[model samples]
Target: MKKAAMTIALLIAVVATAGIVTGGFSYDPAAAQAAARIKVYSAEMRNYFMSDEIVKSKEEWRKILTQEQYHVLREKGTERAFTGKYATTHDHGIYRCAGCGLDLFRSEDKFESGTGWPSFTQPIAKENVKTEVDRSFFST
Candidate 1:
């Protein structure tokens, strides 16, 4: 478990640096109050997962999530562009994971990427998210 956590932490750090490029947009790190918000959300996110890690069976997830969510999250399916609820939202708040309710990104980190999906500059904290290399369709 420790090793896994360390590996995830390292991956998260790498993802943080890659966040802007991955989304094809950038946010101003010098934006007013950005640092304070980051600190607040980072603590909130850390506290959120202070308890046991979440582990749910597919059957359980199906019961908890909508069919669409199950398709996108569990089956690794994609939603049609611009169809997500937060895709065009301009509200200010932290964005939580649909599957586990983990606080993942802040509204401040989000930018207008025109990709029809909500794009964030970074997670609230590197530790709050996980990353993996996608080696699909002849790309890494």
Candidate 2:
């Protein structure tokens, strides 16, 4: 009876351990894989910027991002005078596009240029951004 009870107890422990290792624990394999896939190019590139995985059709983005963000990202819409959030924030993190999750600037690169819009001396990479001339009558 004693030997039988010990064997039963051992089996229970093994099953419990297996359960914890698999289903009962909160281990997210997908997040782990994403973390593992992140590649750091330089000390300046420590922060990871992930693009939008949703792959929204052009029409979908037109429906999703605000008019301003879409204009800035899709149509190169510059923010109005003195109204950008990043202009005043002191938080230490990467500033990403709310529309596409593209890394725009690092908090460390931010500076006060007295312009209403947030100004950064530099971005993480030049290849990450595309710029075009805006010849709106509003600027004139």
Candidate 3:
């Protein structure tokens, strides 16, 4: 992560330097051509991922969700016990991912586990759920 940040900073610095090409490096037409080729490649990559079930950049997600929503969905966060609006909610609709709006648990499957957070018997479908190792400290 640190390396990625550093690389981004370096690229920014290079771009700033490019504005004053005579300062150190000479302007090269080949570099511009190479950049155009990269743009084409990026367009192709975007087209490939366009059909994904959920495809959005981190910034795009942040724009889609409010700060609190992003923290829970993108950051794999858990709401405080007895604090979530849905914790005590009893609606007749399906529970969906706040991030991508994917149908997760149906209202009929909801049950009270006395665990504060909403609990469901099983996902609406196996493909809609992913059970990763919850590395949060709360996952004792």
Q: Who wins the lDDT comparison?
A: 1
Could you estimate the TM-score for every candidate? 0.61, 0.53, 0.59
- Superposed model 1: Cα runs more than 4 Å off: 1-49, 138-140
CA deviation > 4 Å runs, candidate 3? 1-51, 138-140
Order of candidates by lDDT, top first?
1, 3, 2
Please provide, for model 3 over 1-140, each residue's C-alpha lDDT reduced to its tens digit, 9 standing for 90 to 100: 99999999999998888867755566689765554431111221322112234668999999989888998888887778999999989988878778866567888999999999999998776656678886678776
| Candidate 1 lDDT tens digits, 110-139 | 998999998999988776677776667577
Residue-level error in angstroms, candidate 3, position 60: 0.6
lDDT for each of the candidates?
0.76, 0.71, 0.73
How big is the positional error of residue 65 in model 3, measured in Å on the Cα after superposition? 0.5
Candidate 2 residue pairs that clash: 71-77, 72-77, 82-116
TM-score of 2: 0.53
